[model samples]
Target: MKLPHDWFHADSEDKEMYGKELNLEMLSGHFLFSKNIEVYAHRNDATDDILCRHIDAEDLYTVVHLTWSMRPEIDNKHPTVEFHGSYDEFLQYNSKFFN
Candidate 1:
């Protein structure tokens, strides 16, 4: 049988740094209007950036690096959609910080 993906065990103790248990509070606090975003990894507790996937999008595997706007506008909603690409591409993009 095929093994499960690492993300499946994201809540496990071994997955702390790279993967984490889905923090509903964090999602709600950071992304107030985003109902379609499923956050997979929260890199640092100090920052608002998170690795997530668009639940309603066609490509579920597409990893997204999102930075939520600290200040929301009265009429316009804006959050910096920094990067949208494959998981490997996401890793490569963030490799500098890890390495």
Candidate 2:
């Protein structure tokens, strides 16, 4: 998925610094506002970025530990979430990163 302009992300600076492919081993996500939301994932066979696996939303700890690869925001209220970026760059970045 294509991320917005304000998405907050922490890429492997080492990899990017050396022009090497980043092996995204995992990602961590923490629930901030809602009880919990289930998000569906489709296995991808082709990509320009490194991705080992995809995790479900219920497994919030995975995102928290940064063990699941990229975490792009995908929610019904995504527009609202993206707009919430006004709160701060970090929140906006997180919203774009995790949603």
Candidate 3:
């Protein structure tokens, strides 16, 4: 999937406020492979309760759901979130992960 070069660029203040909570670079990397991507934000704190869904090349019929979490710091050793299954199994566990 082709992503806009500026897709990960956020204003300094926006980055300072939410960049640590959700790494836009990592998130964009994951979604680069997605097709028909959709994102929803929580009314209260959009950064804290982000929900995204998309269909990847490996599973055209299944939509993979991803939930983002806030990271205490920028640590590549620890991922900000976790996901289960191969692309194909996303459907089987979709309901469990996503509402």
Best by TM-score: 1
* Stronger candidate by lDDT (1 vs 2): 1
Candidate structures ordered by TM-score, highest first: 1, 3, 2
- On lDDT, the stronger of 2 and 3 is 3
lDDT values for all models: 0.42, 0.27, 0.34
Better of 1 and 2 by TM-score: 1
Worst 10 residues of 1 by lDDT: 1-10
C-alpha lDDT of candidate 2 relative to the true structure: 0.27
Off by over 4 Å in 2: 13-54, 58-99
TM-score of 2: 0.17
Best by lDDT: 1
Estimate, for each residue in 1-99, the C-alpha lDDT of model 1 and write its tens digit: 111222232243433432222232234344434446555554443434556656776543333233333333333212434456665565655664444
RMSD of each: 7.8, 14.2, 10.4
